[model samples]
Target: MKKLVISIVLVNLLAACASQKPHETTAAPAAPVAAAATATAPATATVAAAKTAVDPLNDPTSILAGRSVYYPFDVAAVQDADKPLVQAHAEYLSKNAARNVRLEGNCDERGSNEYNLALGQRRADGVMKMLELGGAKAAQLDSVSYGEEKPKATGHEESSWSQNRRTDLNYAK
Candidate 1:
């Protein structure tokens, strides 16, 4: 009976040992540290998408070099100095009449829409006159008035208002 009982106890112990996990002799081969590095690396396609999303106008040099020119409205009263800028634009247009150019006149938000529209038209006419003087044919240039409908800056402050009150020359191919 003692031998049977000992055998039964030994069998139970063996079964328990079999169910439990065995102790590892060596540490898991330093789980490839490079896996963590590769996981954190930015995807190539995502990086390309991010690059493509950047605005071209964010660069001041690009804005300045572009064919579009901005003219101050009220404060910088139309003066003799502005003639040269207009002339340069006219020359550019003469050289490229096959391409159409739009002169958008804008005004500050100080006046009613009607008044602003008239003022914007006058501003555009002023630019047109100069362009004509500079040799841009009437057929090549088109003028439109945004009035105060579209503003370069949204704030009510004078600085923003000043920026909003301007003419923009946009060239289209």
Candidate 2:
């Protein structure tokens, strides 16, 4: 009977030691498998979702007729040769002066926000001045500077940046 009690005590002591010690293998492998699954699963899902979405802004039919003039990047200092384009746009605006028009000036993200804002304002003002010269009433036109807030394309190349820098003409709804 004493041997039986001693054997039981030894068994209980061994069980306690096993429970108290750190679990070195069983817990460690599960953690890495969980982390690996988490890292790869969501990334592929996001990419697939992005591929399915369509961009509304890229539709050419949404562009307004009179306001759709695409200007070169940073043509603030318009030369004598380029004066005709402005003149043509001004004439178009004057004819539709009864309808309110809004000019949104924009720039690429290369410059500081403040500087870009000022530059965009100047570009819109340049167009406004030409329209006024062509007989559009001052009240008919409204100008706003968007700076680098809206980009035409999401590329880092100069071509994409150049396309981003221009004024967009919006007619009052």
Candidate 3:
């Protein structure tokens, strides 16, 4: 277990170093001291976390980064899997009072234009309600139905349809 943990930590440190741009440096490498290194690890981790929290919406690893909530075929309600995403956005929005979002509801091509529009509205409204309940204020949210007009996927299959049946969280600039 210790070897496995050490190997994972080594891989992560190497990856972090590799991701940085090259820079001129004359400083000597810090000496390896396991106890001292472990003691400072939490401080480094806290700083990294604080940096990400500054703008979690743009952080791909953050739960708030998920901008769309998908539903099963013809379903207007948010699935259990999407609840966490919605809650994350709600918390983020609540904390950042100035940030506003639009709930764009969409649907697959199987339904008539009117039916799709209505369904899309239902989907968007459902997400809006959940966001409000989770902590976001109603004033920060606007609901709109794009119906089948815009699609994340263009193929005519379950893969595409699944993508279309979603409510997108569009943040205002």
Off by over 4 Å in 3: 1-53
- Show model 1 residue runs off by greater than 4 Å: 1-77
Question: Compared with the true structure, what per-residue lDDT tens digits does model 3 show for residues 9-107?
Answer: 656644553343121111111121233335545788775666576576775545665688877668998876577678778877887799999999999
Provide TM-scores for the models: 0.56, 0.54, 0.70
User: In terms of lDDT, which candidate is stronger, 1 or 3?
Assistant: 3
Query: In candidate 2, which residue pairs get closer than 3 Å at backbone N, Cα or C atoms, i.e. clash?
Result: none
Better of 2 and 3 by lDDT: 3
Task: Report the Cα RMSD per candidate.
Answer: 31.2, 28.6, 15.3
Model 3 scores worst on lDDT over the 10 consecutive residues at 21-30
> Model 2 reaches what TM-score against the true structure?
0.54
Per-model CA lDDT versus the true structure: 0.58, 0.58, 0.76
Tell me how far the alpha carbon of residue 74 in candidate 1 is from the true structure, in angstroms, after superposition: 4.9
Can you tell me which runs of candidate 2 are displaced by over 4 Å?
1-75, 78-85
